[model samples]
Target: MNFLQFFVWGAWLISLGGYMGRNLHFEGGQIGAIFATMGIASLIMPGLIGIIADKWINAERLLGICHLLGASFLFYASTLTGYDEMYWAMLLNLMVYMPTLSLANTVSYNALENNRFDIVKDFPPIRVWGTIGFICAMWAVDLTGFKHSSAQLYVSSISALFLGIYSFTLPKCPPAKSENKTLLSSFGLDALVLFKRRKMAIFFFFSMLLGAALQITNSYGDLFLSSFKEIPQYADSFGVKHSVILLSISQMSETLFILAIPFFLRRFGIKQVMLISMIAWVFRFGLFGVGNPGEGLPLLILSMIVYGMAFDFFNISGSLFVEMETTPQIRASAQGLFFMMTNGLGAIMGGYASGAVVDFFSKYAIVSGQSQLISRDWHSIWLIFAAYALTIAIFFTFAFNYKNGLKTVKEK
Candidate 1:
């Protein structure tokens, strides 16, 4: 379950920008707009779906249905050659696909609790396999020459199809029993009350801020690496020829970092751990700004290694924090809210903002009568992003005030 779930995403997520910019000739803003569909769908879908999972049906079953529907969208998206059609298709796909993330977590959590295992301690090891799966898919796309082709969507579609069908066989996760049974509670609108608490409200606001950093690399990392090929001296470099694999080093780093989450969370607590992630993001982009495909390759490698901590500490640990902070009856909905802030609002901010920044630093050039993507000041762009991350980290340090070790929700 964990493996295939991320394998589907890994097949396309990291390489989509390269395909759009290189083959489709999309402008930076258009590419960012398309990626923002994840944010749009996230805003509109996850919480509502969480309501359904919490009240109407089994989470595992809904997860299956969503994946099946998402499979169809993925296949259709591959057939699209225009920006508008592709955008809408991906939006619909994200509408269904985004919800599955939370649903998968709900199922995994339920299964673990039923088995008497500690989620914080046990979940990371299981989730580590998901990162391994993601790395494998990235390698598959890169090695098979699909990194800039529509076929990557096909690969994702088939995997989603399989995971969709296979999901039904997982253990049943029925709706939690509810005594209130009111319309508002049934709709999971109750999750919004977390905002009324000063600490949680601050935490979620920061989640939105950090969330903005999450997809920047996924949107442009490979595109940035491949851009080096335009230079005559670096044309034959391995980083340019197999940029996706080089970028997969981030996911490979994720696998190792995820396993270390339990220790970090236990020792540093959520606030300090998240602070560490914020600082790592600064390094992640700063190193990207200074490195290249040639003699500077080790710096690029260091950036990739830093990605593991930047991503996992905030993402995996953040979800576990949500689990610790919400009541069992509302846990699924709370999880939805957590991601809606991060992946939803956060994604929208990152996508469009990153796009506008790229556009600011780049322009088009005509080469051989084709308007090719060129003249991008990638070094400047990455540095600007690093500065943005550093700014956010500084503010987060002052804004969010949690003391660290996981605690049960203190319902005020």
Candidate 2:
């Protein structure tokens, strides 16, 4: 279930921007707008579905329904030629798809608990397979020459359909029955109370800022690699031709770094671990700015490797921090809030902001007395992003108040 969950995403998530740019001729802002749909959906749907699952529906059944509907939307999206049409189609798809992420986790946790398996000890290994599945999907798409084509969407669609059917076969996770059934409580809005605490409010604010960094690569990394094709010397380069496969190295690194998290957290604590992640993001973007496919291949590889640290450190660690801080009654909702802040608000802001940045750096030419946007200065763009990440790291170091110690966050 975990494998298929991310496999569907991996098929097209990294490559979609390239397809939209090359095939559909979408501008940077338009592409960003399209990706922003995930943020918009993340904002609205996850909380709503969490409420539904908490009070009314079985999670597994809801998961199945979401995927089935998402598969239909993916199919429709593949057929779209216009940016506006594809935007709406992808929006619909994400609206259904995003909730499945949380639902899958719920299903996994419930099943693990029911079988008396230790979730903290056992769940990480199972979750690692999802990253592996994602890597496999990216490889499949790149090797099959589907990365710049609509065929990637078909791959995702078929996988979503299969997962939708398979979800029903998972263990039943019934809604939790509670005696105090106020409207807010019924909808899981009780988690909003966490903002009343100053520390939590501050934590969530930073989560949104860091979350902005997360999807920049997802939205533009492949397109940036493929852009090298515009240079004659790099036209046939391995990285240019197989951008998705090369990018999958990031996900490969993620699996490794995930194993390192407990040690990092135990030794350095959340503050240092997250600070390390912020520093890694600076390297992630800086390396990309300086590296190319030919002599700089090693730097590109290093960038991919660092991406593991950049992603898992803040994202996974932050989730764990939320888990440790919140009470059990609002635990699920708190998790939802963390996701909302990062993937929802953060992604939305990042999408539009990055798009504007790309557009700003794009060069224009007067061709036959008609102004035309000719090329993007990718190096400058990456450097700017690197600078942005560096600024975030600096601010985070001074702003967030937490001390380093193994005793603080380690599970007893």
Candidate 3:
């Protein structure tokens, strides 16, 4: 269940920008808007759907239904050639797709708890398979030439469909028989009260910032590698030719970090674990700024390797934190709210803002008597991203009070 869940995303999430830019002639802004579709759907859907899972529907069944519905949208999106059409199609797809992320977690948690497993320890090992699934999909898309074509969407659609069917075979996660009494509590809107606490508020606020940081690379990483084809010195390099496959190293690194989560969370706790993730993002972006696919390839490799820490430490850890903090009745909604800030609002800010940044440093140039769009200031772009992550890390250090903070949070 977890593997196919991420596999559906991995097929198109990393390489779609390359396709849009290379084939459809999309500007950075246009492409960013398209990517921002995930944010839009994420912002709107996760919380609402979470409420449904909490109150009415079985989470596993909802997960299945969502993937099945989303598969059709993915198929339709693949047929689109225009930016507006594609954007709307993707938005619709994500409306169904984004909620599945939290739902998948909820279903997994339910199954684990029923089986008497420790969620914190066991979930990461299971989640690592999702990362492995993502790596496999990235390799599949890259090697099959789907990385630069709409075929990636077909790949995603097929995966979603298969996962949808397979989900029914998993244990059902029906609505928890809860004691939430008021209408608001019953609807799961009480998850919003988490924002009232100072520490939780600070955490969510930074999650939004980091979430914004996460989207920048996802929007441009593959295309960044593909851009090297324009340069005579590195045109034939393997990174340029198989950028998606190369970027899969990042996902490959995720497997190790995912496995390490149990020890890290137990040893360092959430604040420190998340802080490490923030610091890692700094290196993740900084290395990218200074590296290339050749002699600098090692730096790129370093960036990819650090990506595991950057992504898993915060994202996986954050989800686990929410699962630990909340009661079962509202757990799905809490997960939804956490990701809503991360993927939804954070994604929106990252998509549009990073697009502007890329555009700011980029311009069209006449090269070899041809009008070509050149993005040569990637060093500045990645450095700017690194600086942003660094700033977030610094502020987060001072802002979050972890000692005795969890006590206060639980009391509230």
TM-score of each: 0.88, 0.93, 0.87
Candidate 1 at residue 90, lDDT? 95
Best-to-worst ranking by TM-score: 2, 1, 3
Q: Quote the lDDT for 41 in model 1.
A: 88
On a 0 to 1 TM-score scale, where does candidate 2 land against the true structure?
0.93
| Winner on lDDT (1 vs 3) | 1
Q: What's the lDDT for residue 240 in model 2? A: 95
For TM-score, the strongest prediction is 2
Candidate 3 at 317: error in angstroms? 4.2
Who is ahead in TM-score, 2 or 3?
2
lDDT of 2 by residue, 1-412 (tens): 9999999999999999989877776778878888888899998887778778878899999999999999999999999988779999999999999989889999999999999999989998898888888999999999999999999999999999999999999999999777344555433467889889877888899899888888888889998999888889988999999989889999989989988998998888988998899999999999999999878889999999999999999998898888888898888668777888899999999899988998898866676754445888999999999999999989888878877455754535
User: Candidate 1, residues 281-332: lDDT per residue as tens digits?
Assistant: 9999999999999999999999999999999999988888888878888786
Q: Count the backbone clashes (under 3 Å) in each candidate.
A: 1, 0, 0
Model 1 RMSD, rounded to 1 decimal: 3.3
* Candidate 1 segments whose C-alpha is farther than 4 A from its true place: 54-58, 109-125, 171-189, 317-333, 365-372, 402-412
Tell me each candidate's RMSD, in Å, in order. Answer: 3.3, 2.5, 3.7
lDDT of each: 0.88, 0.89, 0.86
